[model samples]
Target: MEWTGARYADKPTVEVRTWVNATPERVWAIVSDVSLMPDMSDELQAVQWVDGDRPAVGGKFVGRSRHESFGEWSTTSHVIEYEPGRTFAWAVADLDRPSAIWRFRLSPKDSGTQLSEWMQMGPGRSGLSYAIDAMPEKEQKIVFVRMREFEQNMATTLAHIKKLAES
Candidate 1:
């Protein structure tokens, strides 16, 4: 990914996509299973449903993650979007002012599925905000670096989902 020079208040985002040799239904099965995420993600250590057993609009889940710079932390995320085979999204922390928003989108492509994972950093405070607050002058660099990390992690996650769906 290229430098974006984004700031936290800008709600900077990153996305990664891949074409999976499987139906949208197949891809959706994997993407909607929040419990499966920890295995596919580099920083996510665990995830558990907080309200319901399955994905649904308004349902909630908790995710535990670990980052070299920020250490380990957990956050409650509320499902903001859910469309069986098309889209799934959740907002971390406050829904009206989320620290982050994450989503998965799927579309039929030829005989397979086009899948994309997207995330927005913030419109609210998060662990990274502390780092930025500590070095106000380097906010841009901090946001850029974090976005890059998210880009890389999202790509790896998509690759894993593709492998699982295609198999």
Candidate 2:
């Protein structure tokens, strides 16, 4: 099966935002720790240490998560950019698709810290990714649905982190 790009039902991209009642440093502590993701995110089941320093630019890690129909999926991320208490980004690779990117940004605010995550799929290409994309429109919708789920999961994670930091 070949999943041509046409499978997408023209759904708008998904984005979610959440704020934490902790300083950037505090938030960074939780986000930068790749080993703790499974404990933080409701969707992400586990993260295995791949390489590189904690949250440092060039760091690599693999994470596993479950989607509605996909069951369990794994993706690896490489830290392309890192700024202490400001911004951190990861270019995801070696999964169902090769051209996906996930990034996280941290900004300080009067209340605490603002954290955001974003992901983009396709255009890069991989045999498996293309094969999966070949499925029907409903299958294509899973990715978007997961993105939204991640947002809410992340929001809850942030809220927990906030409580931990404030404590």
By lDDT, the best candidate is 1
TM-score of each: 0.96, 0.72
The model with the greatest TM-score is 1
Provide the lowest-lDDT 10-residue window in model 2. Answer: 3-12
lDDT of 1 at 26: 92
Q: Cα deviation in Å at residue 26, candidate 1?
A: 0.6
User: Tens digit of lDDT per residue, candidate 2, span 89-114?
Assistant: 67667433345566668888777888
lDDT of 1: 0.93
| Model 1 regions more than 4 Å off | 1-4
Model 2 accuracy (lDDT, Cα):
0.65
lDDT of 2 at 45: 91
TM-score of 1: 0.96
